[model samples]
Target: MSRKPMLPDGLSSYLAERWRGIGLSLVIVVATIWLGVTGQLGLYIHPRYFIFTTVMAVLGLVFVVSSFVYRTPSSGEPVSARRRAVALSGSALLLVIAAVTVLALPPATLTSATATQREVNSGGLDGAAAAEDAAALVGTGDYERLSVKEWVSLLAQSDDPALYADKTANVTGFVLPDAADPDNVFYVARFVVTCCAVDAQPIGVPVYQPGWKATYDTDDWVQVTGTFVSNPSARSADALAVLPTTVEPVDQPSDPYVY
Candidate 1:
């Protein structure tokens, strides 16, 4: 008859005994890889980090596979009693529960309400770049491609409305009514993600039109197309607001965040 192999003791035994933690770690690794492969990772993080996620997932799988080589402790084995008790604590189980919960839940993007609560920068362009960009765009007559961030920068840097006058803009963003602005004006905002959702910055363009509050509900995504006109009467005296010729409701983009 073949003899049974002896089990590991002490810390080695403790590590091997927590197989559930290893398994849950694998579940999380798989979930992350799936998100990255399906391009759903963009919902939580910037696209640039997807490659790093893939690398980490691969390393995790290797580590989990290697863990199986460790001999599990037998029930009758002489383990350090106090250390064994600590190894089987609630903290480890709670971590497994949290990991499983995250894996089970559907991914969701931050909403317009989140944008309202966050620090919003209409424009953060430096004075020099803002001036240069404002000058370069003066005669270009192109406006349809301008993002909410670009518009915000232009608004902050250029005090003159002529720099924006006769310029048309077509911007897509979710609607968030600026409670402080007139009923005609609402904010079209996009979350600018650097690394992940935690550091996302909300940047918006103010849309000016009467009765917009009644027409568009908060969080409704829309494509606002119109001329960029100076609205001195606007809440932000410096902003050259979009005078929307057509505010059409649109479906949200799959990757809604602006990188």
Candidate 2:
């Protein structure tokens, strides 16, 4: 007599119980194709998306093949052992792929300059010192709170001296692209957040200097040490301003996102 296959009794009945897994596999395949076609796959963990997608396709194929093979009565041997081995192997492979992809991806904090500044400023630094320094330069009479749109206009229309007459005003922000001029200037900006990073609206000052172009790229952390200079071409009627101080480059601090 031939030996029985290494499966529990009623193994054929048990195989029929797993239709849910097969259906799920079909759904996954459809979703993956849709995401890939729509260009939304980049929103996920970049490296793992493709690997997981491939795994889904393979799993679906395996289920289809297994279902067909197991349906044959003469192929007698219980498939339970083989099925369990396949399940365990696929699961282990998936976990390993996930781990590798996560490790290889670029850290999100490293890509955000605003995050870097917020992390440093939040540390037990001297807030009073910063405020006092700003006050001394802006002066009680000269310090004016302007709306973001107004600020943008002033930057576009006015010269820097109008705001920097006192010559020591302090401004803080991250860097953003300049729509008006890409080659010569960029916006030093900060995102104003209502609750967290999600709703942040960027506000920035336009920086214009021939030397700044050569010395710094966008997103570098630097302290501007110069007095304010007004640019007449800026949109602001109030005179768009910039600190002419030397830029002191700093390392990226932990918890880089501000909003």
lDDT of 2 by residue, 150-173 (tens): 333333343546554654434444
Off by over 4 Å in 2: 1-87, 101-106, 110-164, 170-175, 192-196, 232-239
lDDT of each: 0.73, 0.48
Which runs of model 1 end up more than 4 angstroms from their true locations? Answer: 1-17, 72-100, 122-140, 232-238
Positional deviation of residue 89's Cα in model 1 after best superposition, in angstroms:
12
Q: What TM-score, to 2 decimals, does candidate 1 have?
A: 0.76
Question: What tens digits encode model 1's per-residue C-alpha lDDT throughout 1-259?
Answer: 9653344455545564766677777777888888887789998888899899889998998888877687564566766645555665654676677676777677888887677776566323344654466456544766676677667766766648786676787889998766567476777888888788887877778888878777888889999998777764446543567888899999999878886
Whose lDDT is greatest here?
1
Quote the lDDT for 143 in model 1. Answer: 66
Deviation in Å, model 1, residue 94 alpha carbon: 5.7
